[model samples]
Target chain A: MTSSTTESEFGESRESDSDNPSVTKVARSKLSIALAAVFCLSVIMGTGPGVLLVNRPESISGIPLVYAWGILWYFVQVAVVIVASLTVWRSTGVAESCRTHNAPSRPERNSAERGEGELPR
Target chain B: MTIPILVVLIYLGVLLLFGWLGYRRGERSEEDYYLAGRGQGWFISAMTIMATFFSSFALLGAPGMVYREGLVFALVSLNVPIAGVAIYLLGNPIRRAGKRGGYITQADMLCDHYGDGVGLRLLVALVGFLFAIPYVMMQLKAGGELAAVLFSGYDHAFEAGAIVLSVITALYIMIGGMRSVAWTDALQCALLVMGMALGGISLVVSMGGPSAFLHEVNQLPTSSLTVPGNTGFWQLPMLFTVCLLMPIGGIIQPAQWMRFYSARDADTLRRSALIFSVLLTGCFIFAIMPIGLGGQVMYPLELSADGVAPNERVGSFDQILVVMLDDLMPRLLGEVAGATLSSLVIVAIMAAAMSTADSNLHALSALFTRDIYSRFLRRGCSEREKLWSGQLLIFVATAFSLVLVLIGSRPESSLSGLMQMIVTLALFAVAFSIQLLPMTLDVLFIGRGTRNAAIISLSCGLLVAFCFTPLFPLLFAKESSPLILWINAAKELIPMHASAWGLVVNGLVFVAVSVIESRVLKARSV
Candidate 1:
């Protein structure tokens, strides 16, 4: 059941790139990796120890250095989210696929049956 | 007085009307009521998510922290965007799982993943209850605080305000369910954004605009402009841990977990992630941050031997924003306009409080009904029966939180000792919710945790987190006990937030137990 669900969710993406599945797969994988890297970097610089480097009394453009540091990282994080949303999250046929493949056949009748097991990987 | 009262009444009436509309539009199914048929759009999803993520904490507590702590909280505000990022990274998968499996509560999805056991379900539900009640109490307390300021001349204004807010919020969720809650959240989100912008602008203008405001802020004591802040609370380790964990903790709490379930699709959450990060961060940075700095410049805290305290004009740290609006709006904009603007901003603050209260109450109802009542109390209950039970739970939970808030509000009451800044309550609540994080990540991504592991780990996490809360000594430990002394020393040495501490223990326990359980199962099979 889990394998079937996974197949259905990713099946459309495969079909959309059937002409060159390997290239598209590699590209998507690379983009996801890059996005994750950027996100991690932003978190480190924005809120982690990177903040200590800039935590000072001095002002940047009249804003406190730490605050200005936060704002810069905020934009970086926002950019990462936007790029990921438009690229990796933008599946070819997710809405239709999710509806057909993901929707329960009927309302779950019992607690044991409801949310029956782990999600498709 | 008339203007503020009138404004509150009108705002509340609209919220009730939305609740009624949601009732009229809703189907009688449990999913329809609890998850809004899992069809919330990007706009409503984003707004409701934002509105729920922020609470009076955003308006009152955050600025209060900034006012008291200085620029330190401005850095703390960065947590909002991290939460935004989580919406897509964490939320999308959760949504996909929820849609596929027809899950309504956090416990449902989690129990499903860990292979449902009564103990695991109960523990998960307990976590939800613990998170919801304190959070609900905080929102109710905000209402009381607002009323005390807005209706200062009236006797028992605080009590009246809290009761009204609680009753109204409960009624709406009881009537409209998720639809009404989400719609009202949308309107409240708009009001909150407007209020933040307007409040910031008024403060800046009153200080003679941007340059003058910056100059005044710059002139504040060096402590107010640097790390550890005015009170020395936000040390580097504390700030780093809080910024790292609080948002993750906030995003996985019961109310937000259901929001992920309610989202229409992956795209809805994807869009919500972007909007949430961009719009909320903008509001916090531009609008909310200034209010705190301006508060320091306008109404400076008293520096005493004990520590810095709020100015005489300000009743408490949380009251700083309300006091600023009351004093500045009237003085800056003339009598009629200032009062009107003040009323609107007050309503916005109330909106922030109500939006959160309604979501938690609604989510609590679902948690009780789906996770506990139907499963344990009455198996195979009708959909209508479950729905009715959920609604009743909302009313009962609201009353319970109201009573707790009222008790805490009393000066002589022991519970009053527990009540501090709104942010403190928020962090306390988040500590409990953060216990779910290790399990949630495993269920969503890692898929290695056992049911026994989840239960044991969550219990340990909750215990450790509770020890860090202010209520620990009040309830269990004597003030002078070796245990209390050691805990305090540990806290002072580490300086991490309660949520981080809990997550650290929770994550470690979860991994260790899972590994051990897996090994045991493998040996038995062999």
Candidate 2:
């Protein structure tokens, strides 16, 4: 099974230099974060207060003049996610990491890596 | 009685068919039995995630919530697509870390930060499965009740579900390992999408427009719509937080994380998440929400007729969506939609159940094979012994869960509420763990701390959630005389609403404890 282990199978393995984290990279990341924030905001804006804003006779659950409150709740939800994205992006602190212990032996790793997966370009 | 019994038998037969197919294909190698050799493609992987995520709750329960609540409740399900996006964003980190650390379970990621294997996996599994049991029962109970209503209340519907569901999942997981599970999941996802989309639109069109229904809803008093009722201040915030956090809860579930290993590559995992996030969430919400709202509009009088609340009815709030569709709609559409939704719902529910169950079953098998049985029970076991032992353990654990289901599950229980509770609490646990920033700090920065401290922090967070959020209220709040009413009222508050704020409390304790422990460890090293 250990017949193949091509280098290309690995995608930019986590070996980035961070000591002087590049400004351009940081700027690029922030842009991505802002884009995501905008996307989430758009969805929330599109759906959150739909009926609430219209002052329709039919309430969310028949309560008078209350759909606006539900819509407001969605606004807050959108704000929170947007904040988290911005905060996480600003810190450049690593996103949480995954770790496995009790290593399943070198031979096992070799066997598990038996077949290389080809990723599309 | 005979027909119900036959219906159960037929259902069980379907389960057995899947199970037998799996077990027959079982291989001797561990990888074959565990991860389907990780040869799964994007389609299967995506289905596995969607199917696992979709579950019976989405099929019957989420819509039920929407039925009982409103489209506002649809926000609770909005996290569906977010899960796929989250996976895409987080997949590289997860896969990379898994590669570096050789992590198997969801706990590994956190354990990576804590720099230890000590009980993190077990703590995760125990808490998750503990919450999961009620959910498992909800599915079985929903399946049973649905059958009972449709087939005239067969006494053995759940037992049949247990036979069908438990056996099929165990067999596939046991036989094809992750491969069969993923492939089956893809098909399950397809069925779910088709079933829910067609079933939902059909139900909605037949019911007439939602706008017509809302007209009646607006006439109710302000307070009823405000806090303490449907869309109160505390409700949406807590619900939104809960729903938003639901995607991250996947961070802890071993079933979803196992996909980390199952993906063809990190890219495949990302793509699957993005694709599924767009597709499944919409189909699932659309499928169930409209039907639920349709019921909310058309069937309220019947639901609220008795002195009891609408959610506490005999069949179940979750089953109400199906009931409304089956009973009120045109007969042929009802039957076809019923069967389609049921099959879709069944597969989705099964996929959700097994996505966790198979993962749980396999992880437990691995934990036993790698962590416990092989480590302590019998040292120097052979390869075949490990393989067979893993299979045997999966069988035993699954059987045990079924037994637990039979014992723990009550036909009279609230399926919709129980389903929500499990997913809700799982988020609480995960969110709570994020609180132990000290543990995170310790591992990433090599801050001095022992595995014991990290382990305790996990335990502490879990303990706080169980003690304050749920058990305390159940034990004390309802026991007192005047206090009982207040306690019931208090259950609606933010912290009490699914113990939404418990995550905050959990974080504080973990970080404080970890920081203190880190200082102590530093002094010792010095």
lDDT of each: 0.86, 0.53
Model 2 misplaced regions, further than 4 Å: A1-27, A39-121, B1-27, B107-121, B209-234, B301-308, B311-314, B328-356, B408-450, B469-502, B521-526
Q: For model 1, how big is the CA root-mean-square deviation?
A: 4.1
Which candidate leads the pack in lDDT? 1
Any residue pairs clashing in model 1, and if so which? none
Query: Which candidate has the top score in TM-score?
Result: 1
Per-residue accuracy of model 2 over B1-526 as CA lDDT, tens digit each: 3433444455445544555565566565665566665556667777777776666656665665555555555555556655655665555445555555555555544544443354764665465455444444444444554554554456776567666667766776676555556656665566666657765776656645555545544543333333333434234455555555556555435566667656666546655765665566556545665666566555662323242235333265556755664554435455544455444444444444445555556666665665555645788888789878878977887777667556545545332222333333344334443333444344434445556666676566555555444434444445556755554465555334333344555555656776787798789999
Ten residues in a row with the worst lDDT in model 1 chain B?
B412-421
TM of chain B, each: 0.98, 0.80
TM-score of each: 0.93, 0.74
Candidate 1 lDDT tens digits, B486-511: 98999988988877778788889999
Best prediction by DockQ: 1
